[model samples]
Target: MRRFVIGDIHGGLKGLQQVLNRCNLKEEDKVIFLGDYVDGWSESEKVIDYLITLNGNQNCVFLRGNHDDLLLNYLKTNQFNKEWFQHGGESTIEAYQKVDSKTIQNHIEFLESLQDYYIDEANRLFIHAGFTNLKGVEFEYFKPLFYWDRTLWECALALNLNLNRDSVYYPNRLKLYQEIYIGHTPVTRIGITIPHNIANVWNLDTGAAFKGPLTILDIDSKEFWQSDPLHTLYPNERGRN
Candidate 1:
């Protein structure tokens, strides 16, 4: 069984399919998604539909992301206007509008059910963003989990400002997790850099919603596979067809 982790899809259905094809995934293989499955592109409805079909399959695990959280909020209160519009949620709203009410509800349920973070028996962890080292905290705050980044979290820890933060701080250091696979921050390529004073985390967000490659990481072997997102997409036509 091949075990793999895919980075943020962000409405790039074509890129998603290409990465899956490149991986040669089989029924026995296990696949995990790091979130941000919607927004940025015009095909969020399609992505949700695809995920719906994958339900009940033991080979897949989809964790909640900040964008996914906004999507659910929109569904429930119809008031995710600001955050959604700011972060490429306009395209997602259009996609959802085209789908039926029932389908929209189902998709919302799926997004709401997603876990904030995932921890495996291998001591490896997967989260859309890093935590603030909050001790005894069973959950993470909403915005930072989706927006604020490493530097901010590290600074917050350094000054001992966040009284809620639980974990120990390593001065000019980053080793919070045994192994952490994260997305939410886009990079030019799959970042494997782990300097002495740097973090032991791997960032797989290859900017599928923009110009870079869409990446997938093999969990057990630590191998990588990627595909370009540009060639497969059409030029933006102002959200119209």
Candidate 2:
């Protein structure tokens, strides 16, 4: 069965739907979603609802994202963080206003049940963000780093491609996995509107929260599909731009 890795959705349910349809997934195919499923668009609640139903019909793996964590905290405690609101949380809060308490509770449970990271039998590491430990994810001291860290990506970007893996300057963390797939930080930040690879780390976030399209990459073939830019799909909304 083929394996597909999807980037952040950021409440762009239309974009999500488009890419999934384009993929033409089979029942046995594995699908891995690198979080940020909510916030930025008008359908955050609907996105979560769709995913909950999708899980039953598909072989799916969902990773936790920082935005997802913030929403979960607000749902569970009724405490709001100002930073989260400024960074697209307002859209999520607005979307949830019409949702029933039972639905909200179910969403909360789904959020809580998300995995911090997943390592397949092929030795490919899939995480929402980066792990800080040089020894690898199992030795990560800070749990939040799994969904919050950018240092790992930064290191991958900064590395000289010519450097030998056995060299003293080679990053120990990069040696831990055959390949690492992540989202969280959008590749659009670097002016890339598609999945980008730095060393063995592949960044799939094409910034659907802003001006770019949602992306899904075939892990084996490296072929990919994208939806129309989120701005075009939801012209009335500003998204997180």
Candidate 3:
């Protein structure tokens, strides 16, 4: 069975579906989502619903991203925090306008059920965002770091260039996993629009939340696919500012 890992979806159901369609998946294929499933686009609730349906048909691992966490927290405590709202969270709120409470709750439960990180048998680590502590993979870093930190990506960018497998010069987090796949820090920020590899850590977030497309990669084969950029798909919609 082909094992596929996808980057941030960001409520762009079209992007999500497009990437999946390109995967040529079978019943036994495994799909791992790196999170940020909600926010940015106009179908956050629909995106979550589709994911719930996919769970029954495939081996799916859902990891929570910062946007997914914001929605969950808002649903649980009734606090729609301003910061979250400012950052594509409003689209998620809008997406729930006509959605039934039960379905919304199911979506909430799905979000709550998401894992922080997943490590496969091959030791390939899947995390929404890389950890903050460059010192090591130890849990000394805060939880938010796992969902939001860009330091690991930055470190990977540097270490990968030097080709330094040396533990002393490179960060310890690099050595902890055989290979790392992460989302959250969109590749668009670097002015590139495709998945990028730095050392063993691959950044799959092609920025579906902004102008880049959603990306899916085969862990074993290294084959990859991408949806049209969200802007191209949505046309007039202003995806994640």
What are the lDDT figures for the candidates, one per model?
A: 0.68, 0.94, 0.87
When summed lDDT is taken over every stretch of 10 residues in candidate 2, the lowest stretch is: 78-87
Give a tens-digit lDDT track for model 3, residues 28-111.
999999999999989888899999999988999999899989989877776897888989999888878788889978987898
Q: Which candidate is the best by lDDT?
A: 2
TM-score of each: 0.80, 0.99, 0.95
How big is the positional error of residue 227 in model 2, measured in Å on the Cα after superposition? 0.6
lDDT of 2 by residue, 1-241 (tens): 9899999999999999999999988889999999999989999999999999999999999999999999999999988888899889999999988999999999999999999999999999999999988889999999999999999889998999999999999999999999999999988889899999988999999999999999999999999999999999999999984
Reference-based lDDT, residue 216, model 1:
82
Clashing pairs in 1: 133-166, 134-165, 134-166, 135-166
**How many clashing residue pairs, candidate 2?**
0
**Model 1 spans > 4 angstroms off:** 134-176, 189-198, 237-241
In model 1, how large is the Cα lDDT of residue 97?
Answer: 78
Q: Per-prediction RMSD in angstroms?
A: 5.6, 0.7, 1.5
Model 2 residue 54 distance off true place after TM-score fit, in angstroms: 0.2
